[model samples]
Target: MDLQLTNKTAFITGSTSGIGFAIAKALLTEGAVVIINGRSQKNIDSAVKQLQAFVPNGKVSGIAVDFKDPSAMDAVKQKIDQLDILINNVGIYASKSFDKTTTNEWHEMFEVNLMSSVKLSKYFLPKMKANNWGRIIFISSECAQLVPEDLIAYSATKAAIQALSRGLAQTTKGSNVSVNTLAPGSTLTESAQEYIKNQAIIEHRSEEDVADDFFKKVRTSSLLQRFTQPKEIADMAVFLASPLSSATNGAVIKVDGGSIPGIV
Candidate 1:
């Protein structure tokens, strides 16, 4: 389908690689102008080039912002005045035990995972409402529901994201603007691939075996029994960001491959 996204401007955070990058590419493929964000200019530039190569006529650019410093978003504000889509995809996490996790780590997780979306939505939601058309997508995770012992702080932030997205949608009532959260399961992004490779070598096992064991042991609830590809999550995000998803506001849509059990 066309998605009717031509010329729509989109901004995706933490898009240098992984799910965010996949979302960026998907939007660009649909003929949207995409501004991707990363921490360093070098990575941003490289990602922009790769995206352009993938979608030869794509209008793609980048902004370098470290969400750790809240003020860093001001740089982005100066460059763009409005947006048709704002995807809050930047996040950071550390898989450490609760007691072993430092106070600063918890703060960092909240800053990047939750506060960044809060700040960006605060800035752009009003503009979207004024224009009477927009889409705001928050990239949450199944971890919010399946809260693993080592990921308590991270899961807390993700849970907060669902609330944030829903509340923002309430403000867009009777308007074309929509705000929704997408909770993905364990996705096979670049870093995930690297982790599998390292574990395979360390355990003297095949990469496939290491990956399968992850689903069998660590993520025993996953019905798919494997890691989901980044594109799988990105496809749904592209739909949610488009005009076709006008009826989906305030909903926490799961693209979790049944990792999160239960019929919603």
Candidate 2:
């Protein structure tokens, strides 16, 4: 089915790999012009090349500016003058005890995860409202509701981002612009695989055993009993970024494999 997204432009932050890259691929496949972001030129080039190889004739470009830098958005604005979709996907996470997490880490989490969305939304939401059409998706996590002990700061920032998305959606009342949050469960990204490998080696367990332990013990609420693939989450994001999802605004849709228990 056509998503009716031909020629529409989208900018996805932190799109060098994992879920972000997956979203870029999905959007490009749907015939959207996609601009990807990463911290370094090498990463941006690599991701763009991979995306082009995956979707020949797809219009794709890249921006290499570390989101941690205060002037990063300025550089981004210079490259992208406008957009039909703005996905705030750049995020940083630190898994450690709350007490062990440094104050600097907390600040960094808020800066990259929450503040980046704030700034981007501030810039694009107005343009969207003026044009009378746009899509803004915040890539939240199930941890926002689960609030795992080791991911206190990350969880807090995710929850705050959802709130921010809802508030921004409210501003788009009576318009075609929509802002929503997509909450995902733990997915097997390259970094996550490395972490799993390290844990398996440290505990003298097989890789499969380590992943099983994660769902069985740590993520007991996960009904799927496995990792949610990056593409799985990307599918939802691509829809939300399209004109088809016009009715879904100010909502928190979960692609969390039932890890977030609720009826709402």
List residue ranges in candidate 2 displaced over 4 A.
none
- Give model 2's clash tally: 0
RMSD of each: 0.6, 0.7
Give lDDT: candidate 1, residue 163.
Answer: 93
> In candidate 2, which residue pairs clash?
none
Per-residue lDDT tens digits for candidate 1, residues 1-264, read 889999999999999999999999999999999999999999999999999899999999999999999797799899889999999999899999999999999999999999999999989999999999999999999999999999999999999999999999998989999999999999999999999999999999999999989988899998888889999999999999999998899999998889898888
lDDT of 2 at 39: 92
Query: Candidate 2 at 106: error in angstroms?
Result: 0.6
Model 2 poorest ten-residue lDDT run? 64-73
C-alpha lDDT of all candidate models, in order = 0.95, 0.94
